[model samples]
Target chain A: MEIEDENNFKLRPMKCELNYLSRSDGSAILAQGETVVLVSVNGPLDIKSTSQSIEKATLEVLFCTKGGKPSVADRFKENIIRQTCETAILGCLYPRTGISLTIQELEDFGGLLTCTVNCACLALLNSGIAMRHMVAAVCCAVSEEGNLVLEPSYTQVQSASALLYFVFDSRERNLVTGFTEGSFSENTYEEALARCRLASDVVFDFYRDIVKQYSDVI
Target chain B: MKISIGDVVLPGDYCEEISQVAEKSKVIIGPGLRKEVDRVYITKPGVLKKRNPGTFWVDSYQKRYVPSRGENVIGVVVQKAGDIFRVEIGGSITAALSYLSFEGATKKNRPEVQVGDVVYAKMLVASKDMEPELVCVDSHGKKGRLGVLSDGFVFKCSLNLIRKILNPNCPLLETLKNEWPFEVAAGMNGRIWIKANSMRETIAVGNAILGAEYLNDEEIRSMCNNIAAILAGHVS
Candidate 1:
């Protein structure tokens, strides 16, 4: 009776706290509908004085998904995150020095991985790690019928004709990173990028809010 | 727009930044732009400038080519012929590694080199008209460092990056010097072979160590951990 009542009530999955780690240099756990991600940032660690350069600090990014194994999908996500972080961190300043950031995704309930990267980047910035820009990410899936869907679920992605992931410096709206159409042609790529740019606007706005909330917490 | 490696006083078709001109020495060869006698010189493209001491890069995009005698290279076994193995070491036509070269194999029963095996050898001889010949012998004509590398991961990379990696004090080399847990041999040909217990860990470490030349250690380590974490499917 209780289960039937819950179903009949149309209750949705619960959302909870993000960035479960308090002392981590920086951390965040994002819940988007059923999808979830936990991210953390650490370092700006000292490079050996002899090895240190007067340039920019280094930048690093990592990604993980719910499955026990990090599939090709996860590797693709990691690279996109890395590119965005590189644009934001300004690595040329630290010359001989080093800096790194790591992100982990605990679950993938839907098309929320890109949002997770955005949240992780925001968390890194919030932690006061030096960065030149604020980065965010968004995804768009084009259906077989040529309809564009912003942030489609895993099932939708499987059914879609193409998928595009874009990472952006939200404040400036610059295209900081992009990866798409595992098997797409040049023409398809151009269309996906345009669609992704439109989808990125919404994700970037979300990043702005996350930053504001994070700064307020600090 | 035209470009060159470091700074462009004169622009042409090229990618990447020009770092600095190299000193002229007998080791410098090949063309585009090279540092010679402490000055930059642009040699005709697709031409082989005499080997000088100065560091140089191929201005064009081409796979590694077979080396002449006295040239060192790293290669991977990609195919097998009755008694010979097809080896690729950043070159166009895969070099031939004959079964008779390695000391123990006889004609009737030859040594087998499977796909994915890494070997560090020298180009003892090559002629434009024939398949390049690979020799596993040392300068003294000994077979001390010659053998089939059974366990390792091979990867393809840019030729320029490969050149940067071979020089002394190079970032990837330095990282490996700092107590690397695996055995790695980076050939001048852009083929990097890494052997370790954990393939995933080895790859993570390899990328970070190699990336160090272009990125800082902190960044590299972060990348390593990031890759490791992702492979482990763990959340930070």
Candidate 2:
């Protein structure tokens, strides 16, 4: 089957560049709307004996803000990203090794979590680390007008009543992560979940495009 | 998605062709493709490739090396234990190189191997839970093209580039073979050791290999031609 392009996508346009770093094993810079993130993946490299796991490779994730010292919120984001990626990476393939993922936030207009998760997934793909499946993250906001805005901008998020971020794996489209802020009705939450799930397909298509472009060039 | 050969596949995509062949005969599934209970799944983002009767794998670009048994690799000896040497092959851990595994080495006789010396050896035992072991001699006790590589420069590159130059279809090695009198050893771990009459010829070989990393077949041919011409004093 022919791979579908993202022209039919209603979410904000995405731009990405893969394998840009000279030192990192794999790196990618992804910009979703105004939110830009740079991510790099290295390993299964030699692991320290202290942190080695006999059953599987240890995953270490570091989240960096644009500048200054990391705050509690950054640590929280790191946990979320680490959990989401750990689920996807087949860490058992390289037992006693460590896979390190470093993410630097460049621009955070809105939907920071969604953009970060998506960019992290792209970096993992570029690293060629075996993963059970790929993941796509979508952000939606419930505006004061009682309408859901997909991939809300800074101003859109400020005026919105609630914001939701959902990460879905490619296989089965299962929800791997979900984060929300403010209050919304149960019915509205379900509606946002469905819409985010559909929007995730656009991100997956974007990933396919990036991989296909690089593979063809090589 | 029902993936066919040559299709750009993603992790978790299904390939029915392999399952159909499995019912009749055995198939070799390489890296990037995993066999589940009932079907075949791609675990990488790249083109699904097939060879011969039934060998399928996804050719994804990667840098990190995972030691696999029977693959020849170049490593640097890091530590010297009583009976074995710890060689760092860019894997998860240092591989053990037993002294007795060398050619013509007995308990009383030891090969003059030193720390930080580069060697081309074959992986004898590479298991997930066990330490990887390297051997300098073949089963026949011959050290043919697999031993201490001295007086040569070594450089690291992506695993994909190593595979590219080593492939029979790739013109990289074929083009360089005619350029100059040089000896080269490429390890699957992405280290390449090269030696020639002088530094100029050695650098030329290294240049040709590194330059071919991103170039297509046509471009690589011209690049090799240019390097060869420059080295022969035909062009300055």
Candidate 3:
């Protein structure tokens, strides 16, 4: 179940499109390798009186699967996305309002959570919502032979011994969110974090390139 | 790709022209453009447009409507609470339309506004913190074209499409109006109320408006003709 590639540290080819949905305030379709996710953002809209926060906008994330009802795993992914995006968005600017992020899983080959996070960020940017800075997410896995693999596919994920996801902000490349599964040494964790942090540069650069492509039309 | 004015821009992308102009004089940065300490950055993915003397804004395709003052909008009366009617204008919150805002209305005689009726009104006070207020009468206390509309089909479209057809340069409405007699009221809230003599004509008008979203002026004219021909059974 091991995938031996010459460039194990490199990410898969990425594609991003903004304003994919006309109804949502902001929308984007993002793909990482075989994984695809559609994210839509609606907000600074009215919040329910009971759930409204007086100081800042309330962030709500809903994750939908390709079919059937959402499971507990989907809810977990929604929480991670909400927490990561909460820091990136300037919610305090729109008080007592609510910002809703909806993620639709198009295809899941692997790295679904990371792809979802990236798609949400792009959709947020497309919505013209004010934010302190942009965020990017990268996922990495450790093979049975202790080799680091970046952007692994579904088969590779099943064989991997340890998996880690890291989210970094554009301003300082600081760690905004991090999640890991499986047991690993502290040294391995730090090494994986550093590797994913470096790999995150590619995602951020992709974001710039996508924006630049559209900016040329102006 | 090289970026320039009128090109689509994204967040974190800055404009040198804006910064250079800001150094000499004050420049008004509108929506989608933000002024930082060092430079002016775009905060949305849309075409950057500039007016003659320094006003710059990004024209992006958006669906959600944000209430702004002095814009005519079509809203549905959702509630009849005391003197003020709560109207849903597709904003974050409902707008308040007072009974006194209508023409020829007094404390003794209330305006005949019922729930679920579509009204074309102008936004008087649209602020972020305060609820937006709507008026059906102008300063001259005349109803003019602002009042409850009856016997029409209302549909929703993107805010961008609404602006597109409302643009003075757009040929969609002009071409369609010549082909058939139809009345239309476009709201800044992305809602349109159109009335024609027949259902088929109503559907034709709606299709023409929706189809013209991504088409050019020439295409829109052709599309309107195609729709008209189809409605008249001229097209095989």
Candidate 2, after superposition: displacement of residue B147 in Å? 0.7
What's the count of clashing pairs in each model shown?
A: 28, 0, 6
Report the CAPRI category for model 3: acceptable
Better of 1 and 2 by DockQ: 2
Query: Between which residue pairs do clashes occur in model 3?
Result: A46-B92, A215-B8, A217-B7, A218-B6, A218-B7, A218-B8
The model with the greatest DockQ is 2
- Per-residue alpha-carbon lDDT of model 3 for B78-187, expressed as tens digits? 99998999999988899999999999999998999999999999999987778899999999999999999998999998888898899999999988888889999999
Q: Give the number of the best model, judged by TM-score.
A: 2
The window of 10 residues in a row where model 2 chain A has the poorest summed lDDT is A1-10
Candidate 1 vs. truth: CA RMSD?
A: 18.8
Interface RMSD for candidates 1 onward, in order: 21.1, 1.0, 3.5
* Native interface contacts retained, candidate 3: 0.35
TM-score of each: 0.41, 0.97, 0.87
Candidate ranking (lDDT, best to worst) = 2, 3, 1
Candidate 2 CAPRI category: medium
Q: After superposition, how far is residue B26 of candidate 1 from its true place, in Å?
A: 57
lDDT by residue (B128-226, candidate 1, tens digit) is 334578877665656776667676787765444565566664445554445436777666565677777686668765676456544544555566555
Model 1 bad stretches (over 4 Å)? A1-19, A47-54, A67-76, A92-95, A182-191, B1-236
**Isolated chain B TM-score per model:** 0.63, 0.96, 0.94
